[model samples]
Target: MNLISKLILGGLITASLHANAMIIRHDVSDGKYIQQAADYPAIFPLKDDGKTKNCVGTLLTPQWAITAAHCTILLEPDSQLEIAGNKAKVHSIHLPPEYGYMKAIKNEQGKIIDIEDKVKDASFDIALLRLSHPLKGVQTFPLLEQKVNVNQTIEVMGWGDFGNGLEGVSRKERVNDRQLRVAHNKIDAINGNYLIFNFDAPDSKNALPLEGINGPGDSGSPALIKLPNGYFVAGISSGGDYPGVQTHKREGKYGWQEYYININAMTAWIAETMALSITKN
Candidate 1:
């Protein structure tokens, strides 16, 4: 199966873990921007029960957050966004028109049945969430409007799930009290709206000090880039790619390809969406 198909199947075909994505080959303490809770308050978790994180999102404004479109299933009226010990209710969601092309088949229980063949447009795997109220006192992230080059280093932050690339993502590491972790990886390729990265082995020459990739439970997490001025939201954690390796598979081991929805390509759509929200209120 293709990498995108495998990723969609892993989440839809398999049971929902409702956990956060973990960073392989890195510990929480080693994170430069995510070591403390207050460091990057803009990053938060999207939850249905006001606790269990279904996906991660980055704050664009006090009332706006950006995440993957597939995560919209969890953003019910009662869904909550937890950030820095504060919880905000999700008011509404917005998606690109092309997202309609990527349909998901669900069973009677509202559980996703199959999306392997239905995911037609991976390029539009992006979404914006409007919160009921403004997240006062919290800083928001700026969208990356500039083009990103391949091999550019980016900072990835997410919540929950923990393990090294060697063992892959361990179910034992999935925790309820999700811990936020950060790691670094360089973009290996760019495909349409996606920025791709290969999780290099620890000893690999191209490996960063905290080289890692997103594992299950981290969908919608932000891939941040530190520009000369400040930090920018460069991409969103969309899925993973494992071509031929049969053993480790999508366990987030070395050689896994991480696909992030490029944010620079959708800045215009994001601006227009946020403007619509302003017009509504």
Candidate 2:
């Protein structure tokens, strides 16, 4: 269980480091309303083998979609983007110049000693996908440039396994069939290139009606905020952890924090990459 394995095989594992959770709320009874259908068509799933959707992506352009770099490892030649029940072929996958695995420095006996930090110790986890053809009629979202303030509310949408905070995201609560869900959370903090959201208990004053955080199979989904003009993507789903909780419990529990790759901080790289990708296409 090194960093490489976590990032490479995370999507297939229940609690891998790179596996982003589905939206889990404090109110389990609201599951019916929290589930969505055909909403946020711009956010779609990335199939791992042309069959199973292990990660999700956002439609930045008709011809371009963005996702986590770690997901690229599981994508196959026949991997397709499932959008509104239609599929688009992936022409190419592009990683940022900074994209690379974080390896732990080991001792002579292979016990880990030190770790390397890059891009502020966060994985440059973003990636871009070039589609073989432009997606017709689907709406696209713009990346947020202005800094998002702490305590501002944002929406998270994706297709994955979900459950209530009381039982967490494991066991029978995790559905085999992925469903589209949207949840809201306020920005707890901003750490380097990541946006942090904590899953507040239903009784907590900070909890929203559908308060939730990311969970398994939500990797690469977008944390969005709507402005007067339209919706803007502020962060990409990355990973989460339960701070100071020693239960070693499954993810998506109450008090757990979800980390999203801050899209605002990576707008420069995203814009540059999209421009270059379009030219190549």
Whose lDDT is greatest here? 1
lDDT of each: 0.75, 0.69
For model 1, how does the per-residue alpha-carbon lDDT over 187-268 read when each residue is reduced to its tens digit?
A: 9999888898998987789998778877787888888899788788999988885656544433777788888998878888
lDDT tens digits by residue: candidate 2, 47-122: 5433335677888778788887765654644566677666788888777766664344557985435444332233
The candidate that wins on TM-score is 1
- For candidate 1, which ten residues in a row score worst on lDDT? 26-35
Looking at model 2, residue 138 earns an lDDT score of 80
Residue ranges of candidate 1 with Cα displaced over 4 Å: 13-16, 26-34, 48-52, 101-118, 170-177, 244-250
Clash count, candidate 2:
5
lDDT of 1 at 205: 98
Which residue pairs of candidate 2 clash?
A: 20-215, 21-214, 21-215, 21-216, 22-215
Q: How accurate is candidate 2 locally (lDDT)?
A: 0.69
The Cα error of candidate 2 at residue 173, in Å, is 7.0
